[model samples]
Target: MSESEQLMVVDEAGQPLYTATRQDVHTQGLWHETFHCFVIDSIKQQVVLQQRADQKKDFPGMLDITAAGHLLAGESVADGVRELEEEIGLVKSFEELHGLGVYQEELRLPGFIDRERIHLFLTDSAKPLTGYSLQTTEVRRLLAFSFAEFARLAEEETTVLTTVEGETIQRNQFVPHPTDYWKTVYAGIKAYCER
Candidate 1:
């Protein structure tokens, strides 16, 4: 089934309520569960970011999470590991992921209201950017950025730039995740890297 047609376990303002189609959930501004993974290369102290496919209905052509997707109805958070492979072609087990806890996030677009109880995770990888096999329909390409530099960008109010894939990448180039969201991400990956 297409992602938009898939069944999602709905939440009413963070409380589990019922099941609805992905389309219904977003159009109605209902809450839903989502999985977000940040792939880090500890040896290189960098993290991978995927450029969403231009054809995507939401956030198309924008640099976003390393891998992320909504959880289907009846699926546990652990089941989200499939997204890692499906979106970026990195096969990994659930036990290999470091839990970063769940976060409440909401996005208000012109026609889309996305409220997600995001189950965040972090995983270490040493593979080069070329090692990833992009799911062309979902992700356009992957770029690696310095972990420390990314954290700085997330924590600071001023503009920060980092070289990614031979091009300069700044805060505006990414999806506008709230500052608190990025701080949680930075702290999670930083703690994981130090472990």
Candidate 2:
């Protein structure tokens, strides 16, 4: 098991309050900062997604963002760029990322209380599927979906056939983020591509 990490706790308004261990933050429902990155291959109209490792404590075995992780105590949002390299072996400078804005979300479950302010970003990558080096402990594999198909499934809230690691899968296999969240992410990437 991985040791608990220290995180910078914040208030509803996103002001830093204090520091606490990752376990305590989730257990107490404290708000914390997190970074989320979405990789889009606009030219190919595809988005990269990662399947969370089954051993993960939260949302294990779920398909999630291209890269995401918490901000350690005393670290700024820019420091979060490390997640790209750590989780998916994508080394990118902060300047290379396009900020998509922060989103606040709270999820309460039986043994988890996750309140997070997510600093979202969008990046363009033409790298092939085989180029990513998966952190076996955090991510299991990588997959891609066309923007059109993603929007269609998100709008219908229904599953669609897709490919994952050369295997056919359903779109609902993704993390169950709120529909609006998916819309916002889609719009962000669409706008970026348009620019």
Tell me the tens digit of each residue's lDDT in model 2 across 39-157.
Answer: 88888889898999999877888888999989999999999999999988998999999999998888888878889999999888999878999899999988888887666545755
lDDT of 1: 0.84
Evaluate all candidate structures by whole-model CA lDDT and list the values in order. 0.84, 0.85
* Candidate 1 per-residue C-alpha lDDT over 61-147 given as tens digits, one digit per residue, 9 for 90 to 100: 988899998888888889999999999999999999999998998889888888889999999998888998899999999988887
The whole-model C-alpha lDDT of candidate 2 against the native structure comes to: 0.85
In model 2, what is the error at residue 165, expressed in angstroms?
8.0
Scored against the true structure, residue 154 in model 2 reaches a CA lDDT of 52
The candidate 1 region of ten consecutive residues with least summed lDDT is: 1-10
After superposition, the stretches of candidate 1 with alpha carbons farther than 4 Å from their true spots are 1-4, 10-15
Clashing residue pairs found in predicted model 2? none
